[model samples]
Target: MNTAPRRPVQLYRALLAAYPREFRGEYGAAMQQLFVDQYRRARTPGERTALWLRTLADTAMAAISEWLKAWRTAPPAARLVRAAGILFIIGGIFVPLAWWLGTLRPSFDYPYRYQPFVQDVLAPALFMAALTAFTGGAICLLLGMWPAANGHQRLALLSSALGSTASIVGWGALGLQLGDSWWSFAMGGLTLFFLGVLWAGLAADARNPLPHAPGAWVLAGLWIPVSALAGAVYEMVTGRWLDGPDWVFGLALMLTSLGMLWVGRGLAQMPVQAARAQDGGDA
Candidate 1:
């Protein structure tokens, strides 16, 4: 009947907020009564400590289960990233399909290298659409990870904003037929965009809640920079997107697409993982 012993019970009652209102409304009183009884029965300090620890563990498990069932209620950041993931996946699909379609065109076929983004009917349409989606998605990925960013949000945002703007403007320049070659204008934007992606990946990796999510982002970011650098090197050596066999470029694209797919999946599962992390005080 000592009042001091009831503090633990009170704390546990407050922690009940972890459960949904409907659950509490239905079983709240009974659960509290049971906890009170259990606390009172713990006459020794060690017993009370044990009970509190056990109760917290049980509550964390229950909270994770219940919260997962309400994943639709995840924070805005989670939803944004989820949507970005889907967009990335869509872009990934479009790029290869566009490449395949472009390969069928006799004029654009480049042996030993992946087909470059080209101006055509369906292929160009798909390629542009894919780039638009990818740029938007990459920006969202950066913004979505903003809240959880340990210290890299500002740099990530600046790079993405500048890069995305450059990319969009570069495309606009081509649309206006301002450039002699698409690559002449496109390379600048593409370079900035690639850098943005690199920083964004690092930012996401900093404090990302989902497993392997950062790795996926990094993989998605790596392809372009590597490809561009290699292409530059190849140009210096022999030019023309590389000499000899061209499987490496093709493989990089394939892996980048896979990386997008992985990032999409990870974002999809992020709501559950984030909720659990927050509940466990790890978020």
Candidate 2:
């Protein structure tokens, strides 16, 4: 047996890239050597497993701590953009989690089967947490995106901003015991948000020319409408006149999540005009 965990070592190397650049420059070689030594010394599979669990936890904490330190020291625009990006990624994580939580309601539909603590407290708490994080992310994104935008990007971002506001109002009204009518607002808001994102993706690509073929934005643009058309086609084939299969919505939701994630990543990595000005010695 080779005993050398090729995949784990590769993943660890990738995770190490998340650390601060200066920190890596100083400690990178030593850290990789230490991990290899520790892994090889573990005589049993269980020991290796325990080592990995500990390593993962420590890596996450240290990476976060290092990033926070960097954030504190970074320029104002960079700080804001990084914060927005992190918030967006967090929101993306929560979207599916929140959706999954909602699905649990039907599982415990009956009062006898349901626990009040879960329905009354846990679910609402989780949902509120998601809402807060996601809304904050959307607002921050608008702030970060506004600076470097051209006319088309500005227009798209304005649409996204409106979508964000509508979503907030919809979610807030629903929270306040408002009627089911608010759901329409919420749905409309999400549609606008997706549209704006797809539009922005195209505009941004035109400006920057993404390295990939056809581009990720194009995939998202194609998928959003295709998902709907696919759903309708399935509905027609299955003779479900009014609706399509559940997976239609699921597939769309998955694409939207991916699209949002990509958008956040791009925005986070984007050049801050202020930072660029400083580099160029322009006041």
Candidate 3:
């Protein structure tokens, strides 16, 4: 029997390069040999094409599965941070929606107008949702920041502590029905400030490159200052508290939350990536 075509074998070898260098180095020759053997056995063009296609699909799937496994084996701290990132995102979404539906919607026509149903039922439920968001988000942030702290990340530690504290205070204020009071404003402002700090620190931390897409962490960090400025301007121009036009604030909140989620995901995958890189370097 004739040997397998050199071009097809070379092409298959190229495809296998999609895997990590470690994996390719360990099993590449064996895999190439097996593929060549199979190729030589196929008589028809259709059969050969089918075999190559199957090999490609199988290779892609195997690579993905291995990567996932590596990610799953990441450090516990990374996992915790990832969870926190998700909480930030969750709180970011529901908190705004709750505000729009429960408070803003009722008061749009008449500012501070109190509807009995909205105030008595829907408002309370939304408040609970907000409370959950704040509490959960705080816990996640604190947990996520713990590893960074141990790694001697002073800015990260400080920002995490402040952010977590603000979240807790925000939750308590909501529980006390002090939503419109000075306490709420102070805590909210503090929260925003610390979030900016956290993101700045994250951006500066060369040791830990955020796992999310580029600019996401920066944007999330910047949103706090920008939103605060906008709210301040609105307050100044209108001579009233920032309220309504819920869509704008809501959209901003969602984007920030999504950014947090992405960052957390990145943090979670960091350990695995680092380990793989170290292994590759060692090899």
Question: All models: lDDT?
Answer: 0.67, 0.63, 0.59
The lowest-lDDT stretch of 10 consecutive residues in candidate 2 is 205-214
Estimate, for each residue in 1-283, the C-alpha lDDT of model 2 and write its tens digit: 3335788778778878778665787798788878888889998999999999999899999988987886676656455556665665665666655555545544556453465665556666665565465556556656655655567767876786687668778877887879988966865665565566567667754333221232555543455455545555777798764355666656665665665566556545444434333234242
| lDDT of model number 3 | 0.59
In the range 113-180, model 1's lDDT, one tens digit per residue, is 34344435668788677778778776776666665655665576557556655666677678677875
Better of 1 and 3 by lDDT: 1
TM-score of 1: 0.59
Candidate whose TM-score is highest:
2
Output the lDDT of residue 236, model 3.
90
> In model 3, which runs have C-alpha deviations exceeding 4 angstroms?
1-73, 103-153, 178-190, 197-202, 212-214, 233-239, 273-283
Worst 10-residue lDDT window, candidate 3: 274-283
Q: Could you give candidate 3's per-residue lDDT for residues 231-276 as a string of tens digits?
A: 7789899998677586777776666666655554454334434333
Q: What TM-score would every model get versus the actual structure?
A: 0.59, 0.69, 0.53
Write the number of the candidate with greater TM-score, choosing between 1 and 2: 2
Note the clash tally of each candidate. 2, 0, 1
- The TM-score-based order of candidates, best leading, equals 2, 1, 3
